[model samples]
Target: PGRGRRAGSRRVYGTLEDLLGGDIFSDFFRTFFGDFERAAGRRPGRRAEQELEVTLADAYTGAVKPYDIIGPDGRAHRVEVRIPPGVRDGDVVRVTVPGLGDLSFRAKVRPDPQFERKGDDLYVEVPVKLTTCILGGEVEVPTSTGKLILKIPPGTQNGQVFRLRGQGMPRPENPSQRGDLYARVRVVLPTRLTDRQRALFEELARLETAETYAGAR
Candidate 1:
């Protein structure tokens, strides 16, 4: 059993992996589920919501998630939720209750350790060596699917953002169209510099100082 997390008006059980099923769903899984309802209609007897926590991978590719709800008979009834691709956090999936109105399943997308999602776009911080930032070089960038080589032009500064087209999350409305992935440059400085490196840096510093002095004049 995993820890419970509060979602909206209900408390949900299971860890991120247990609920969303984990990274094994990396393949391009076709979504059979259709668009779900976002708003609920006025009903006389509506059951309290049961929350579901889904992973980014699960949201990326639609998967069937199993859930249990208390039936009006006071028995736990298990149902498999057909999750469509590109489902975002806060989107509710309505489950049909034999007699009691509809049971709501509020989706809570588990936060990714390496990526931050905004709408359909994804943002990631890519670490680039100081030398690579100074001189033109290629750095491997992590995407939802895999790593791609990103060329950092010469004089690329720290915090510089690069957009990789069609790399972000797929839109629920249109699975073929994707937003974009923003790769922010995080310049990593060397903690320990070799004697040769120190000497070269010293020479570069002298050159910069000379250039500044000349500019002042």
Candidate 2:
């Protein structure tokens, strides 16, 4: 009975020594402590992620906006974020905070009413009067930058698209370069016609429907 008791004690001591001397005990404790630290929210220097809402113009022009963040100590602080030009939706911007963890900003660009942006290109619709379409005059068109004077050719048809070179949103890769702007022409007809205008139109219609017009054509 004494030898049996001694053998059991040796086996227990050997098992403990093997556990302590090898990396098994240290690794288990390290993993347990790491999990506990994470669960208890005591991890140091953890990064934070947030979303930032920006306007299309702001994204296009590149702006410095204020960002409010709550630190681990529960104090609110304001930070200035530099939004690069041509930043698109879902793009990430990183900023390092002193003592706090790094902050990541995901850009969310709002839609613009004046322009429809698609892959750096801008599209807009311009309304042109019937007389201007027929007489071929200059019409003011709205672009991403500003108003532009677009020449309307004589007998410009409705739904005609005109391409304005280098007048679009800035390219994300190269802000100095830009894309094109497509302006679709929408002709606006006269709502009410004057008596003299009706009379002249009646005469023109009579001339147009005549058999001689067909023969001439």
TM-score of 1: 0.74
What's model 2's lDDT at 204? 72
**Displacement of the residue 215 alpha carbon in candidate 1, Å:** 14
Highest lDDT against the true fold, candidate: 1
Q: Please, what are the lDDT tens digits per residue for candidate 2 over residues 86-152?
A: 8888788887789655657777787888788888888999999988987899999997667999999
TM-score for candidate 2, residues paired by index:
0.71
User: Model 2, stretches more than 4 Å misplaced?
Assistant: 1-48, 207-217
TM per candidate comes to: 0.74, 0.71
Model 2 pairs whose backbones collide: none
Candidate 1, run of 10 with poorest lDDT: 26-35
Local accuracy by lDDT, each model: 0.72, 0.70
